[model samples]
Target chain A: MPVWQRIYEEINDPGFVILCAAQDTGGEAAAGPIFDAANATFIQVVDPDHIISSAFNFVNVPSAAWVDEQGKIVRIDEGTYSKLHELGEGDTKISFGTDVYSVALKDWVAKGSDSAYVQSAKTVTGNIRQHSSDQLKADAAFRLGNLFRTHGYADKAEHYWDLARSLNPDSVNFIRQNLTLSEEGSAGETFRDLMGDYVKSGKDYYRPLDIQSPLQPKDEDR
Target chain B: MAKAMMAYPELRHPFAEKPIHAEGSTTVLYQGRSITLARTGAGAGLLIQPDDLPGINGFTLKPEGACYEDLCVPIGANLLVDQQGEQWFDLTGFADLLGQPYVADSEQRVWSFAEIPAKRDGMMLDAMAPDFKVTDREAQVVSMADLKGKKALIVTWSSW
Candidate 1:
């Protein structure tokens, strides 16, 4: 979040805006402090219903869409990262993210349609995930669960949430959001196992980034 | 064990147990909006008042059909039902006609509906942004239409 705030400041283009949404079912209590710590000046949304994710058909967090001035989606559904980040220390340290996506974003903001990073409408539409009937029902079920959760119907909430997971087993957002309620937490053994199965089954947790970094060239390009 | 990133087991059921709505009222969830209707027709399916159509899903009762934007769904026998002396719009039936999925808890009189398929046609064909309305931290409503002339990056992240 702080990283996004930094990037938003660096871009500093009045015409460019970043709407960062927290897809946390825990609502503002869980996500508000993080945004405040980042000093986010751009649009900040604390979405407990995961409305943004459902709007874009994103199965996981850290996903994004780049909408141009015409309200057309120029780039979408990518695992967006402003820069490389590391956590912990010593052998237990974990590292993730990339610095390249931020540079490409800046290019798009400055160059608009002329930016090589901007994809064609055809490609953008092609990249969008086509959800099935059951998957659509899953969204409804998830919202039903959220409604129950909000109203203190814990039993009903659990039931519908379980139903949602069964209807759309591929939704990592649902999986992790459900796990957040458990004692082991979201990144626990269950999440790791599900991610393992996801990889073993040849499913992409995120769509591969199409932009190429100028610093690292492919063998063919080199 | 991996360190827990954004766990909140304590916040799971923090709110006190209470009924979802008043005894006679019905709650409808659509596109992230929760609308509680004070009056409805009695039936196993959701039969909302014709006048409450626009607030629920932005469709209005017209002479031609239930109209929204440029698209109109011709009124069908199952869509508009006549119960006794009242005319109630069958919302669940309309959802079925539109292939819009929904989950209903009849006991609680709550129904949650997914995005209407017709509304997403532009996004599927032309890569247009879907119509979504959400509120910012300051409680100002924001919609895709609000970002018309500016380049916007709408990103989703979670604590977990």
Candidate 2:
């Protein structure tokens, strides 16, 4: 069963509405299942040119902003829905006790902005993220890496990607794509061997490869 | 006036050190140490650095009053006046006369007068934080300023 089908079945309630705002970059194909499964009205705003992203300063995907019926914003949070039953539980455990989405959603439905839990303007002003010089440099490197990748120079792409990762180690896409690319080469024989060593040592680089076998036994035999 | 013929019993050197006492009207003291105390009209000490002759240098308090040592002038409600005929308070003169600067404690409260070296300028307290705006799926602006008069909380994150 597709992910969208599952989501459609889950949010069948009449009053519930799921709004998915996606940047039309790389992840839309992965998000297609969920968007299709939504039973409520779905709004897809695609920034194929990334103009909206630049205007909104969106650095990552699935970021959402909640607004009231009057079009006034009430909350903004990252959105992620997975098919795994334990996904929500795992997210709760990892988010350091700050499950803002569930709590804020309930509050918005119950009391609107009049909720005592809502934050004041001053607090919001003090908490916003400002772009630093380091982040700007990382962005430049990441863009250069993308250009290299698109222009048929994988090695140059990898170089810029490495620079980007070093500059901003916290970037999830940078880490994920780099590792995934490393694993995909030559049926991931090298990646699987590395994974075997890591497993033997009780260390984990990332989620284990769940697809077909990563090892090329013929190459080893040769 | 209770007068006592204080003797230089210890053979105090002219330029070494001198003890200061408050007298009723007339003040008679040794001059070799190059210390002057002025009674400013506002009753604040105005200590002047010896290097800079004339300017509102710094402030200090002494047994006599506030004094500007650069001009070697005594300032008070009636003694001295500014060019505009306004009463002057010269604390720089008082320090130049006192030959020492007032020291302040960790809490920025004044402690005692001591010959202290000048300090380098302190680090700036201002810091630049990451500033960004959040918007909804519709590209609507959601700024912190919009939340004024209402309570709100911001959760920073990304959904890669």
Candidate 3:
């Protein structure tokens, strides 16, 4: 069984109320399968406008915020892990290690705040990377690209799209979306080639985007 | 009114027949009629329009007082007119500002604002998560506050 599948089963147990809050910054089509397979109730919040993510100070996906009974945030850990999976045995290594995550979660549930592992509010805030002005500009450029795409200006959109990619090279959505757009038209070769070069650099930032391409060998075996 | 005229010397609009003194961080004139005037630091002041409430910290002038959704705040005796003839509010005089019934005091846990340009960071994770409701899948009325007592793990995932 897959790690997520095992996690799903554990969640479905009657004692546990596995409420998943998805930061659907763009839309909700991708996480649908896991939610369904887990047979668990998933609450999908839309950030199609990114209003929530910006307000909550979320910068990464698979980032989990643990809220206590009083509604105050208790823990925030990045990445997901389950007892059923290995670290490098998948197309994506987005999962956090199972041993570390399970021990922490079990301690949290058993002892609540008394748990020594419970992180302080300062530590939680410290874990969040402070966003820079340059990144905000890149985000704006990407938004403009989306707006252009919506308004039927695909060619002009690529300019802002390329600017966004250059500013924030790790954005898989921008990379893959622009690459797909490039394949649709003749103008995107330079941009596509740029993304190809980033892939060659062995940066984990582009891993998710590379999953769609057949050129790269699957990282699971390696 | 003595209070209004004392606080606001420039509030000499012809249409402000019954200037109501409302106090806050600064004194403000609520004209009975519509007119525009430039205040020193707080921008311009005009007749309280119906639609302008949401933009002004989600406050609307009501018959009882400044109301927000289900709560209402009373103007009380602190509302006064000054000798020079202007209206002002003694914000400090309003003891129960937060507890004002006219003001919607519902505690909201979720923050819903856009990112400002001052903080620049590249997109770290971009994905859309699914939103489901307690009773039905199509119900969109799910609020983050509803899950207050439970530990919620919000995983943002996007298929696109």
How much lDDT does each candidate structure score? 0.89, 0.34, 0.40
TM-score of chain B of each: 0.94, 0.20, 0.28
Off-target runs (Cα >4 Å) in candidate 3 are A1-34, A45-56, A83-99, A136-222, B1-113, B116-139
Q: Write the per-residue lDDT of candidate 2 for residues A116-218, one digit (tens) a residue.
A: 4343333322222333434434544554444334434455556666776676543433443344333133124444464465468763322221111232111
Model 2, runs deviating above 4 Å = A1-25, A37-41, A45-64, A67-100, A180-222, B1-160
Model 1 chain B: worst 10 consecutive residues (lDDT sum) = B1-10
TM-score of chain A of 3: 0.56
Better of 1 and 3 by lDDT: 1
Q: For every model shown, what is its TM-score relative to the native structure?
A: 0.95, 0.36, 0.48
Compared with the real two-chain complex, what DockQ does model 1 have?
A: 0.78
Ranking 1 against 2 by lDDT, winner: 1
Query: Taking the true A–B contacts (Cα pairs closer than 8 Å), what share appears in each candidate?
Result: 0.87, 0.02, 0.22
The sequence of per-residue lDDT tens digits that candidate 1 reaches over residues B35-126 is: 99998998788999999999999999889998999999897777888989899999988988899999999889999998998999999899
In what order do the candidates fall by lDDT, top score first? 1, 3, 2
The CA lDDT at A188 in model 1 is 86
**Candidate 1 lDDT:** 0.89
Candidate 3, after superposition: displacement of residue A221 in Å?
Answer: 39
User: What lDDT is reached at residue A185 by model 1?
Assistant: 90
Candidate achieving higher lDDT, 2 or 3: 3
Docking class of 1: medium
